[model samples]
Target: MKTGKRYSEAAKLIEKTKTYDLEEAVALVKKTASAKFDETIEAHFRLGVDGRHADQQVRGAVVLPHGTGKTVKVLVFAKGNKVDEALAAGADYAGGDELVPKIQNEGWLDFDVVVATPDMMGVVGRLGRVLGPKGLMPNPKAGTVTMDVTKAINDIKAGKIEYRLDKSNIIHVPIGKASFTEEQLTDNFQTLIDAVVKAKPAAAKGQYIKSLVVASTMGPGVKLNVTKY
Candidate 1:
């Protein structure tokens, strides 16, 4: 892979072997974000758990204190009054029978998040094969599947995010944009770290959080001292 000039310069600024404190890492990430566009800042976590074990799975949702800088496009699966409620609550697209077919036949997926009312799960279930892989499937645990379509849509629009472990036992989540104030980014980072820590499975042994790295979209990864969190 060929490296860009800006990325090479940014990488030079970070000590490859040094693990920084939470605040120091956050500051460095912000300082190194030299993209012309406001790049998104993300935190990647390597957890000590077997993702294959159902009980050891680390998955849940949290609302960032400062919210993700990007606007979320929400799609709601519902019918009747709930459909109107979803749209009124700012859902980008809301429907039921029509939606399932459009996605099933046309393969249309233009939304970021998917919210489905409980009653419509049966219909939504058919699209699991498509949405699941994209992490857009509405799950009860993530609060994306519920009776209150309005609240679900509003919460998603307000920066509620779901984090789940990947096959490699790593979780990558965006905390905020590079343009966010250091204080705002730190607050969001702490809120997510607290949620991940509290969600530790009893079956998880040894160090629950193995490693953590914070980085901007185009900047080099800044390793953080997990103990500092």
Candidate 2:
């Protein structure tokens, strides 16, 4: 069976961690928080009901954080009004009909994400065959198809981490690696947990945040028992 440590373990680790001062603890926390997933993360996205859906179509955004930790060129399909906006918003490459063939080349996937203004979706939609398989296609449900290019670009750059429920409805995200100082990792974990808890949909009742865990690269996982805000 897979028995895991309880939240008390984290509190114990917190108490046992040695620190000369508050500042030192802060610095150490940042340096020590890191974790490595055993498997490859293909798609990272945030999901929630838009309140418009009875079934919760899972609306959110996905960006190749760390730019996929690899180089990904971007293709934008837009015209007239939204063209310049896409570029200024930090899209790697932005254009209209010209972008389709570029995406056709086997190498087009070298880019990470593709964004299209709602107006241009008609044109960009044609490239679905090329972009869909690569997981590079833009979908409105993911918040990629939008007129607010600036917000999209800024969110991608700001370490907009994602969280989603597993078969157990438990959401997970990496706050930091084990090497990070306890304080630094704690802040990251706290920030993400707060956001997720606050994002709870009306359909979710009883315990919204079921549980939380913090682990480090090559370290064991420790659950966190969060109190309601």
Candidate 3:
């Protein structure tokens, strides 16, 4: 994994051994993002809890005040008036059984987030194998599976993002783009941290947030001090 000269230069700006405040880390991340395109700034959380334990699992969603920079394409799994309701609510693609084959056999996956009505779960269940592996499966915990299609669609359109722990117990999520102002990035970053901290499972003992890091798509990781978290 050889980094380009620009990436190497960007890496120089980050101190490998020092932990920074959230704002300072975000500033460095923006400065180090020298890519021609607007780089996505991602926040990586290394949690002390073990993902293997059911009680310790952490998963939820939040709508960023400033919103994630990218546009979100939503696909709703519903039927009857719900399908029409989903479309009217701004779902990019809305339907029932028809979407199953398109995603399974045709491999048609031209959407970012997937939302399904409670009753439509039966149809959505058919694509479990296809969607599960890709993390596209709608879940109640994330508000992707609900009876209120309009609210779901509106929240997603307004920059709602899901955060869940990976197998390593780390949660990786995009806070904003490098083009975002430091204040905006800091606001988004703090909002995400507050949500995660609040969602902490009682089963999770010891240090909850082991490490926090923020980095640009093509830049080196800048560590954030967890003491204040």
Provide the lDDT at 197 for model 2.
54
lDDT of 1 at 192: 95
Q: Quick one: best lDDT, which candidate?
A: 3
Model 1 lDDT per residue over 34-138, tens place: 988999999999999998999999999999988999899999999899999999999999998888878988989999999999999999999999998999989
Quote each prediction's TM-score: 0.97, 0.57, 0.98
lDDT of 2 by residue, 3-120 (tens): 2343333234454433234233333333333323331112112233333445432224334223222233455677886778878877787788876777666456656567678888
lDDT of each: 0.92, 0.51, 0.93
What is the C-alpha RMSD, rounded to one decimal, of candidate 3? 1.2
lDDT of 3 at 124: 90
Q: What lDDT would candidate 2 get against the real structure?
A: 0.51
Candidates 2 and 3 compared: the better one by lDDT is: 3
Clashing pairs in 3: none
Candidate 2 ranges with C-alpha deviation above 4 Å: 1-75, 101-107, 124-142, 166-170, 174-184, 227-229
